[model samples]
Target: MKSSESRLGQWPLLAEAARRDRLGQALLLVGDEKGCQSAATALARWRLCEGSGEEACNCRSCRRQLDAHPDMRHVRPETKTIRLASVQQAVASSQSAPLWSPMTVLWFDPVTAMTLEAETALLKSLEEPEATTQYLLTAERRDQVLPTVVSRCQIVHLQGSIRASRPFRPEYLADRGRDLQEDLTAAAEAVRGRYLQRPDPRLLELFDVLVEAHGGIDRNLNQELTRETVAMWWRQTVGPD
Candidate 1:
């Protein structure tokens, strides 16, 4: 939607979907955090834009979304896990009509952090979606989310790392649980350091796997399983490192 193409450039399919009005009621954006958020924000703007197709016309609705409009509700985990209360609130909010815009947008990030109970509640909301409301869920890896939850949404996978967009700034990461953020940061740094040293194609693949494993961890997957998986990737890439 914005003139800059740093983040949304990697998600041409999403833009095409918006332009064609083929966007589903629920969308699951999977990939790097910043990239997913950027794409989601772009979709929100596109949906509310007055221009034909994906081109943003800088209309009042579009400007509101860019300025964090009340009609656009953002849901992120306040702690290590997304609680049931948050999911309930989201569901309740979805039932209401937009205050100013034509439709309401619910933006949920890092959905892998949702607890089983929370996700179950969200699944109900997804099953009977409101026609006037749309959902945008983001996660690092699709596998980390429940298949039931993923089933109800159109999946979009971003390929390249993009600059974080406005409205969903890096500071929002602090609200996703500080410890989890630190863990992901440390894991990324470690894998990045190794990749930088070797610069091998295989190492890059390993880094991707490691990123998925980090998402698994956020989903409360078995720690031993994660460790074994990472170790296996390490063996395959760097040979016991």
Candidate 2:
């Protein structure tokens, strides 16, 4: 896997923000987890770096960030969900000044994993922006995130080249009929191939719909309904052939 700085180079808007020191206090990065993580780390390094360009400088702050700086705080859920205690800790940390760097970064990966109470607590901090602090939130899917939290931050959608090392397989349809499963498998492969080739917004949207439909099936949703949803997404995104 590539570093966040290297991965972020493909995104012009985000790269420009980091390089020009124009990044906002709150940022909601939506897309693949790997890319989002790299972008978040790249943004943090850019903010702390003393160099003139967008890339990280060889300054003390940049060096410390590379090695995990003390001022950089990471808030992650211990279990499957983020607790309110974690949000409180992050909020408290945001109030303090940076120990070494010019700015303090609070990175929350998979922000959608946060519980309602945790999100509420984090919302309060976002409402009152801090000058010397930056909040970076990454989500694999945007729709799963709270609208209020989404509204408080600048949203960045990232798309990177999809590696073909792992081919598409419809494992979620294991309990479905064999024929239906075979059809879905073929559809999944087609969508995956198109996405790998182009990686356009339409294909990304279709991919998100496929992921949601898979989750819907796991939750005991109507199999026919899920199948229809996937079919609709395929028609709308990829169309015929």
Candidate 3:
């Protein structure tokens, strides 16, 4: 198998940025889903790959690195927010040199999860990154990140490309569904004990089906379902039991 360093696709702008060593303070990959993160990660990997040219696309290093490489670090939230612990690990990792390549790459995905504390901690490392350390950060909303963090990173807004793969399941679908239901219940109880605003039974039933499907999103379940579910949940909860 060729290395990841050797198999990077040619993106003129990114190539120029890397060729000029204008990695700048950092790189921000803004996207709403996994597809965006993957693209951003690929770009970061290609830039840091040890191939002879801009992106050889057939080197052993490139291949291995793209699939899973020690030199490439991906930081994400264990839960909803990027906790301080994860940020600390990333910081420490950034300080180290690549185990296989000349440079080390770090990609922070779904940066929206970074809590205030985590962002503060990350600022220090981003301000003075290691000589060979480079970062590729992805966020759904650029405004969600602190200005300080954004200022230190080169903003690369990715649009339209959808990541067509799934990562490992973190939580069971039914459990997530129950959690959502409970959240809805709590919200409903908060609005002056109103029960009339309870979500539609049909919507809840659909969610139950989805939970059973275990993250397998069906085409039949359109965006309207999501909208209706949330609306019903809010309406029911606000009205009373």
Candidate 4:
């Protein structure tokens, strides 16, 4: 584990689990996006490090891995979902020895983004793993994942990211569609939590757009159209509108 006084803090339990070879076949790390990604990256670097088994975070291998070396496979969504091809590629790579070392480290960030087919393909590999392959999977919401996959892994809940602020009053979202409510609630919580340094004029514009999306989704408008409208609005709201 890294020093407790370090900015990254210590993860003695995870370190011990890895040392004991009790990290299970698959490690499911659950947290908000930022926290999950950070933790996953740190763990991956630790595993790849040559200086210290517990992730000294100062070794040459650790530096390269954290900086995203070619040998360290990072599987993520190229589009909305993780295609079966991605899983196949990862599995194939896992079978091979490391490009730079003896161990292969694969980080499947946001593993839930994987499509059903991709996930099933991944299961086969997980069921029969190579002695040198290491897998780290992260997810924001586990309920969205397939139970079969969930059951195969050791769930490591990492409650590091800040939570979503309480949603807008249910009455405020009463007429909204489930999707719009989710979006508005996210936006409202972001703004209310003071995530932005200062109120952007575009934020007011986004609020207006969310109002419109809520109405459209509620009215059963065209799903594609509603999504596009809301996306454009969000882009403008978050961008230099």
Candidate-wise lDDT, in order: 0.65, 0.66, 0.55, 0.62
- Highest lDDT against the true fold, candidate: 2
Angstrom error at residue 75, model 2: 1.0
Each candidate's TM vs. the true structure? 0.60, 0.60, 0.57, 0.59
TM value for model 2: 0.60
lDDT for position 185 in model 3: 25
lDDT of 2 by residue, 45-160 (tens): 76555554345346676656353777787877798988899888877886878887667888887798899999998898899967888898999877788888877877765542
Ten-residue stretch with the least lDDT total in model 2: 160-169
- Which residue pairs clash within candidate 1? none
Off by over 4 Å in 2: 1-8, 19-21, 53-56, 65-67, 160-241
Query: Tens digit of lDDT per residue, candidate 3, span 147-196?
Result: 78887776654442122122212122124444432332233223212212
Q: How accurate is candidate 4 locally (lDDT)?
A: 0.62
How do all the candidates rank in terms of lDDT, highest first?
2, 1, 4, 3
